[model samples]
Target: MTFLAISGSARRASTTTALLRALQSAATPAHTITVFDRVGELPIFSPDRELPSPPDSVAELANAIADADGLIVASPEYIRAIPGGLKNAIDWLLSCDALIDTPIVLAHASHRGDDMLGQLRLVLGTVSTRFNEAMFLRVPLMKKTPEEIARLLSKDASQTELLDFLTRFAAYCGSAD
Candidate 1:
């Protein structure tokens, strides 16, 4: 089974990225997990300019999503909402009719008053994507240290919960599930 773990945060090594890593640890080595952290490469969603042809990077990203058996997306709240970069990627993916109704497992890293998951759901829902389990990281003292945040994101129960969720999806190529 192939699972594409998308880090909604474009940063190199963020809490959101770490969360994705921990999720991968629960999966068998054969599971094909690709992380898309290059939101910066996706151009803005301009219907007119993108009509005749999509940008090269946008096309590639869409193709990848369509081929994946399932998707694990971790979106961090920015400015009390979903970041524009992730929204842009979603917009491009929606243009691909073949990828609609794909199973999406959503995760979020939120501290303060942030409801980015709601917006992400709205975006994916509009495109007819089927949502799976939703995970949230909202520990009280994660601000104190990385170890604390890592522990919360990599908790044993959480990993098992995620693994069980992914197992229910369609056969992932070579996936032990």
Candidate 2:
């Protein structure tokens, strides 16, 4: 299975991105996880641009989403809400058919982003019928450097948890009913 993991943080060294990257390494031979950390590169969405075609960045992201078997979104809380960039990326996809039936889940890098998580769940559920509200992975990597996070996630216990999460999500994606 191929999964697209999107990092909501645009920081040069986001712990969320590190967590997703670690998941990439922990994936088994039967699965592949690709991290998409360029939400910041997408221009703010507008209804007017949806006519002829969206911008190249928006098209690229939509294409990736269309190609992936599933999506895993990880985001940081910003003022108790979803970060603007991640929300913008979703907005850019609202009219696109890529997300309508895609299997999606959430991975949380911080233990403190429940507020953002709630909002993200609501938004994603609205956009995709296959959004799995039940399957989630939350690791408390907040305030840690990306390097530290990478090392921590490399530990045996963390690897086990990540692999289990990926396996469950992949099964969910492949299930017929």
Candidate 3:
């Protein structure tokens, strides 16, 4: 199975991005994880702007979503909300002729307990995207030391809670079909 990660944090090595990569690495060997890093380039939703020809970036994103079996969204809380760029990516997806039936897992990271995760869940719920079991944790991973973070990203990540969540999600995807 191919799992796609839609990242809202565009930074090359943001905390949320690093955690997501860790989760993907922790998943069962039967699954393949693909991170979609083009969210920042997708044009904002505008029928007129894209009528003649949709942006190549948008099409590339759509194709990635189309090809995935399941999706994981890891967003950062900006002003206690999901960023407009991520929202626009989802909005542009709604205009596409194809439907994204892949099961979605919503996740977010914040210094405080922010609403980014809840907001993402609402957006996905409203769009008819299947909200499979999701995992949400704060930045720095709560009491984990730098050494622990490094260990979690390595081959032993499966023993961590984040990996446990992905293992559950992977099972859900297999049975949901």
Candidate 4:
């Protein structure tokens, strides 16, 4: 199975990215996980630009999501809501059909981002029919380095939870076949 993981933060060293990296490492050899940490690079979404030809970055993001068997998103909460960059990326997909039935799992790396998570869930549920509310994972990884986070994920308990989530998502994706 192929999983596409996206990090919503644009910082050089963000907990969101660290969590996604740890997820990438935790995946079994039988699965491939690709992390896309370029939410900052995507152009601001506009319906006008959607008509003729979307930007390369937008097109690339859409194509990547379309090709992946499943998607995982790790986003940091900003002001009790999803960050602008990540929300912008989702907005770009609104005019397209790439996310119609794509299976998605959401992860948040904050101790208190339930509000943002809820908003994300509502938005994703509205946009994608296959958004799995049951596959959500929340780990308070703030202030931890990527290596530390990866080591934590290597622990038996953490690994089990993550693997179980991935396994369930993989099964959900397979059901689409």
Candidate 5:
């Protein structure tokens, strides 16, 4: 199975990105996790620009999501809400067929982002009918370096829990098809 992992933060060393990297490294041989690192490169979404010929970056994002079996999104709350870049990227997918029934997993890398998570749930719920609210993952990773976070996730217990959750999600995605 193939899962597209998108980090909603634009920072070079974001914890959200780090966690996705760890997920990529920890995935089993049967599964492939590909991280999308160019949310920042996507243009602000506009309906006028979405048809006929979208930007290369937007087309690429849509194609990636269309090809993946499931999606894993990790976002860091900004000012108590989802970041603008991530929101923009999602907006670009509003008209894409791929977003209609794809399975989605949301992860937050902050201790307290319930407000943003709630909003994300609402947004994703509209985009995909199969968005699994139960598969959400949250880890308080503020102030930690990527290396440090990776080390913690590498521990047996943490790795096991994450892999278990992903395995279940993959199974769910498979059955949903």
Candidate 6:
């Protein structure tokens, strides 16, 4: 399965982005995980601007999502809520057919951010029929450097967990098809 792992952080050195990158590295050859860490590049969504067609960057994101078998989203909590950039990306996809039936799951990078997670669950569930609320992976890698995250996730135990999670999610996505 090809999964688009989206990072919801705008910061260059974000733990959320690092976590997605780690997942991308851990994925097996059969399961291609593409990490999209550029939500910050998408233009602010506007309904009027979407009529003629959305921006090039937004279209590129939509195309990537369309090509993927499933989506894995990781984000950081901001002000006890979803980050604006991530939400804006979702808004751009709201009217696009690519997201309506796409399978989606959440992978949290922090031990905290339950608030943001809850809201993401609600939003994603609303947007996509195949959003798997029951399938989740939460690794406590907050405040860790990218090097530290890579080292930690490269361990045998962490690799097992990541592979297991991907296997189950792949099955779930297959079932939907």
Q: Pick the candidate with the highest lDDT.
A: 2
- Candidate 2: tens digits of C-alpha lDDT, residues 37-81: 999999988898887998989899999999999999999999999
Write down the TM-score of every candidate.
0.78, 0.98, 0.81, 0.94, 0.96, 0.97
lDDT per residue for candidate 5 within 4-89, as digits (tens), equals 99999889988888888878888899999999977999988888996797888888889999999999988888898989999999
Stretches of candidate 4 off by over 4 Å are none
Question: After superposing candidate 3, which stretches have Cα over 4 Å from the reference?
Answer: 97-100, 111-113, 133-148, 155-159
Instruction: Score candidate 5 by TM-score against the native.
Output: 0.96
Task: List candidate 6 segments past 4 Å from native.
Answer: none
Ranking by TM-score: 2, 6, 5, 4, 3, 1
Instruction: Write the residue-wise lDDT of candidate 1 on 33-117 in tens digits.
Output: 7777888778898887577778889888877887887777777778878788888887777775634767776655545535676
Least accurate 10 contiguous residues by lDDT in model 4 = 145-154
- Measured with C-alpha atoms, the lDDT of residue 138 in candidate 1 is 34
Q: Candidate 4, after superposition: displacement of residue 41 in Å?
A: 0.4
Pairs clashing in candidate 2? none
Q: What lDDT score goes with residue 85 in model 6?
A: 95
Poorest 10 consecutive residues by lDDT, candidate 1: 135-144
lDDT (Cα, tens digit) per residue for candidate 3, span 1-177: 888888887876566666777767666787788877667887678988667767888888778878887778877777888888888888888777433566777655445535766777787777744775444434354335546666655644334766676676777777754
* True lDDT of residue 94, candidate 4: 77
Which regions of candidate 2 deviate over 4 angstroms? none
